[model samples]
Target: MDLVAINLIDGLFYGLLLFMLSAGLTLIFSMMGILNFAHASFYMLGAYFAYQISLYLGFWAGLLIAPPLVGVLGALIERYGLRRVHQFGHVPELVFTFGLAWLIEEVVKFIWGNNMMAYQEPEILKFALFHIGSNSIQAYKVFMIFTSMAIFIGLLFILTRTRIGLIIQAALSYPKTVEALGHNVPLIFMGVFGVGTALAGVAGVLAGPSLGTFPGMAVVLGSIVFVTIVIGGLGSLWGALIASLLIGWMTTAAASSSFQFATLLEFFGMTPPADLDESYLRDLWTLSLPQIGPILPYIFMILILVLRPYGLFGKRDA
Candidate 1:
C-alpha cells in the first residue's frame, strides 16, 4: 500500500511534467490547427538552455530565462519558417517542423556534443520532504506538482479572464469571425504559438535534471508527448489534463508492479511448450508500466481514436 501510494505520487508528478509539455502543444494545435513536430525539440532546447543559464544564474533563474528564450526562438520559427511554408498547407507546416526538429537535434549535438550533459537538481530542492510508511517522497517531485498546477491555473486565467485570452479563445472558436472583428489574427496566432512552445521549454527546464539533458532526449520523449495530446483530445485542455494524469498513473503503476502473466498462467494450469523458450512468455508476463511508458500513451491514443474519434474532449472533426 505504501508502495502504491509512492507510485501514485511519483506518477502524478510525471503527469504534471507531461502536462507542461502537452498544454502548449494542445493550445497551439487547438488555436492554429498546426501540428508542430518540433515541439519536443523545443523542450530539449529548454533543458540545454537552462543548463547553460544555470551555470551562471542558478536553477530558478534558468527556469525564467530558458522559457522566454525558447519562446523567442519559437516566434522566429513561426514568422520565418512556418509562415513561409503555410501557403503549402498543413502538410508543409508539419514537414517544416519535422525538418526543424532534425536540425535542432543536430545543432544541439554540435554545441553540447553527443554525450549526456550533467544536470543536477538545485540545492534548495534536493531534500526529501517525508516518507510514506517506508517510501520516501522527494521535495523536487512535490515542487513539480505544484509548479504544474500553478501553470495550469495561470493558463486557465489567461484563457478565461484576460482580454488577450478572450480574443484567443474567440479566435479559436471562430478564426474568420475574429479576423473580421478588426483583430490582428495572424499576430495572435503567432503569439499563441510562441507561448505554447515556451510552455514546453519551461517543462524541459523543470524536467531536465531528472529526465537527463542529451541530444537524444527529443527523440526519446517527442512522440509520447504527441500521443498524450492525441489521446487526451487535440483541442481540449481538459482532455490533455486528464490524459496526462491517466498516463502518468498508469505508467507508474505498471513500473511498480511485481506480478507476471506467467504467474497467472501457472495458477490456471497453463504452460508454454517444452520445446519453446519460456523466456519470451516470461518477458511478456512480467511487463511493467515504466518499461513501456512511452508506448502506453500511443496504445491509449489508438483506443481513444477508435472509440472517440474526436478525442476524449476534442470537438474538432478528424
Candidate 2:
C-alpha cells in the first residue's frame, strides 16, 4: 500500500512535468502549423538561465525572470529566422529547426561544458511535506505539482474565457478576417510562438533542480515531448493532459512491479528449456517489467497509433 501511494504521487509529478513540456509544443504547432524541433533547446536554455540568475538573485527571481527572457528570444527567432524560412514551406522549416537544435546543443556545450550544474531546490522547499511508510514526500515535489496545475488552469481560462483567446483562435482559421478587423495576424503568430516557448521555459525552470541542469538535458526529454503530443492528438490540450498522465502512471507502475517473464511463461505452462545456457529464448525469459519500464510509453504510443491513427482526442483533420 505504501509503495502504491508513493508511485501514485511520483507518477502525478512526472505526468505534470511532461504536460508542461508538451503544452508549449502543442500550442506552437496548433497556431503556426510548425512542429518546432528546437523547442526543447529553449527548455535547456531556461534551466541554464535560471541557474545563472539563481547564483545572484536566488531561485525565486530566476523562476520569475528566466521564462520571459526565453519568451523574448523565441519571439525574435520567429520574427527573423522562422519567418524567413516559412516562405520556403514545411521541409525548409523542418531543416531550419533541426539545425537550430544542433546549434543550441553545441552552444550549450561550449558555454556550460558537459558537467551538470549544481542546481538545487530552494532551501524553503527542501524539507519533507509528508511521509508514507519510510518514504518522505518533499515539499518541492508538491510545489511543482501545484505550479503545473495552476498553469493548466490558467491556460484553460485564457483560451476559453477571454477576448484575446477568442481572437487568437479566430486568427487560426480566419487570418484575413482577423486582419480586416485591425488585428495584425503576423504579430499574433509571433506572440503565440513566444508564449509557447515561454511555457517550455517554465517547465525547464521547475525541472532543472530535480532532473539536473546539463547540456544533454534537452536531448533526454526531446523525443519524448513529440511522442506525448502525437499520442494525445496534435493540437488537443485535453489529449496532451490525458496522455501525459497515462504515460506517467504506466511507466511508474511498470517500474514498481516485480513481475518477471519467467513467471508468466511458467503460468502459461511453457517451461524454459533445460539447456538454458544455449536456449534461443533465454534472454526473453529473464526479462522483468522493471527492466523495460522506460520503453513502455513507446510501446503504448505504437498501440495508440495502430488503433487510432488520429490519436485519442485529435480531430481527423489534425
Highest-TM-score candidate: 2
Q: Point out where model 2 deviates above 4 Å.
A: none
Model 2, TM vs. native: 0.97
Where does the lowest 10-residue lDDT sum fall in candidate 1? 271-280
Worst 10 residues of 2 by lDDT: 167-176
Best by lDDT: 2
Q: Count clashing pairs, candidate 1.
A: 2
Q: Please provide, for model 1 over 1-318, each residue's C-alpha lDDT reduced to its tens digit, 9 standing for 90 to 100.
A: 788789889989989999898999999998878888999999999999999999988999999899999999998888888888989899888888899999999999999999988887899889889999977788888988898999999999998899999999999989999999999998998898899899999999999998899999988888888888898889788888988999899878877776566666678887655644556565656554457655666788889889988888888674
RMSD of each: 2.0, 1.1
TM per candidate comes to: 0.94, 0.97
The 0-to-1 C-alpha lDDT of every candidate, in the order given, reads 0.87, 0.92
